[model samples]
Target: MTDIATKPDSIIAVERWNTFWGARDLEGMKTVAADDFIQWHATVRKNLTKDEEFDMLVEALKVMQITFKNICLTPMNNDTVLQQCVADIAIEGAGTRNDVPFAMVFHTRGQKITKCEEYMDGMSLPPIEFTPQD
Candidate 1:
């Protein structure tokens, strides 16, 4: 079995999860999530399984056309990473654009992410419409 950190799989998984704006490869996103992974969505105002949260994110992305463009990552020891991202987010139907700042802490076991805690400005960016796709 190949390890996640030193291998390509880990890198890909991290990208999919951390940069999960809308255009990220969703199929690829599955590889990094643990079977019972739990994610707390700051924007959603809920705590859900990885699968559940991912679906919500994707739906919002489709209608919103948002993306996290320039992201800076900082390694906080081997098991954790601190990230700051500036997203060029747009609401497709509304024809609006927002430059949002977000921060998250990632905890990885080997290559797979086990826990992710995200923080963002609630006042600047209101909760996005996360209704699932029909």
Candidate 2:
């Protein structure tokens, strides 16, 4: 496994994270995230720690059968990166699927992400036609 911290640019860390998720490699997540990483998700309405966030994401990946496409990654500065992507979520229980567009901002210190904030349409949960099965 390549060490995430060895990368000279913060954007590389974000790219590595994308690759890990695309491959569904849970162990690779540890390399790109700081031990104390925090994630603030708009849909969740709460801040989650590194483990909590990844655990929840893993569950979502299974139940939602998520697939990502049309991703746009930008390096805003040395410490920040921005991402825009479309996520297709399968809600088999609701007998529906939704294509949602979302944006995220990643804050990095060195090559590990320290914080992440995600923005999407929602009130309490995602503002989509299908209800979350979980």
Candidate 3:
């Protein structure tokens, strides 16, 4: 990972996050995130970091699913951070997570996410991958 505390790279991480999240590729997600990455859901005071986040992500992906659409990024600053563009995500169960906007603040040192704070609604997500088996 390169120093994200610098410009461009911080921006890159923003892109990486959206890509990895959309795919739900655990291994791929790991590559861009810092070993001690931290995420704070603005709605909740609880904080998650390191293995906790990874474990949660893996477990969530097991029954959790989401498709990211119309993802765009707005730079909050030159190197410090940016805001995710508004989007309408199609969640299998909870209906469309529409016009749902999120704010991502990055604390980076390399081309990796050392720490992150994501703001999103806490509405219950529907059972993921509810694809019916024929």
Maximum-TM-score candidate: 2
After superposition, candidate 2 runs with Cα above 4 Å error: 1-8, 95-98, 123-134
Q: Itemize residue pairs with steric clashes in candidate 2.
A: none
Off by over 4 Å in 1: 1-13, 16-23, 131-134
Query: What lDDT tens digits, residue by residue, belong to model 1 across residues 12-131?
Result: 456667554344666656667777667765655556778786787677657766566567766666667777886666676555556688787777775677767777765565445664
TM-score rank order: 2, 1, 3
Tell how far residue 130 is off in model 3, in angstroms: 17
Return whichever of 1 and 2 wins on lDDT: 2
Q: What is the lDDT of residue 93 in candidate 2?
A: 64
> Across residues 34-117, which tens digit of lDDT does each residue of candidate 2 receive?
999998878756788888888777666555665678888777865899989987766446443456888989999877889889
What TM-score against the true fold does each predicted structure earn? 0.73, 0.78, 0.70
lDDT of 1 at 59: 78
